[model samples]
Target: MTAEKANNLLEQIARSKKEGRLPPVHDWHPPFCGDIDMVIKADGSWHYMGSPIGRERMVRLFSTVLRRDDDDYFLVTPVEKVGITVEDVPFVVTAVQVRDVEGAQVLEFTTSVGDTVVASAENPMRVELDPQTQEPRPYILIRDRLEARIHRNVFYELVEMAKPTLIDGVEWFGVESAGEFFRIAPVS
Candidate 1:
């Protein structure tokens, strides 16, 4: 993408963020205007033209306008929907807060983009084990089908807090949030 076009895209998204209290990207049905060179790396960093987008405010603005249609991701406004590449999920859960609520532990995760979501039935946590490396790829739903991958340290914290539960007579290790138990792994 040309510098002019990239600047235009930024302006459009920034304008959209300014117009709405919270960007209603789900309501925007702009036409697909083709792909942008922006990429969201696995580490939750945004890159444009191969350089990291160091502006935290701008990144937060872009996150508001981000949308996912099926498997593809886009930055949408009332006028345009521009595609972007995502290595894993679009955000990373960098911090976590845990509290007890009515005998249940509620876990709230804060993403790198400044969005916080409490894990529940609606915002469930899931872990995918890599077949080759056997590494755990943990994620939690943020909103509207967008997910944030749990950072390594945060995941370790979760594991430390996990309790073993018996499901169907099988012992499984998991965490509790909002009265729901999300299985992280089954006992070997």
Candidate 2:
């Protein structure tokens, strides 16, 4: 990315962060400024011009303005929008916090970019098996079509908390969070 372009993007994100809220990029209809040499890799690392973004604060700031439209990702502000590449998803679930509220289990996920979201109907978790490896790839919805891939250790924690239950005549292993049962795998 060019210095001028990076500076413009950083300036806008800094302003939005200072307001303590994200700007409504979904509501804004700005002209696309074409693609930039930026990519959010599958492991949640931010790269610009083929180099990893070393600053945590800088990555966090850029994440706030990220938006997904259809299959494309963009860094959007009110006045400008620039497309970027994402390998898998934009975020990664770094940690999981399990809590009990009135005997109901609640799973809270902390994203790499520092956003926390409770697993519920609004923010649901799903697991998809990898086609080649057949291993489960779990993800949790964050916000506005963005999802976080659950870390391996966190997924192990979830598996430990899972219970066997029957769903629609099929035995399943899953966990309940926020009164919703999310099936992790079907018992054989």
| Candidate 2 structure, TM-score to reference | 0.97
For residues 25-110, what per-residue lDDT tens digits would candidate 1 score against the true structure?
Answer: 89989888899889999999999989999999989988988899999999888888899999999999999999888877899999
C-alpha-based local distance difference test score of model 1: 0.92
- In model 1, which range of ten residues has the least summed lDDT? 13-22
TM-score of each prediction = 0.94, 0.97
* Steric overlap count per candidate: 0, 0
Candidate 1 regions off by >4 Å?
none
Task: Give the Cα error of residue 74 in candidate 2, in Å.
Answer: 0.3
Residue 183, model 2: Cα distance from true site in angstroms: 0.9
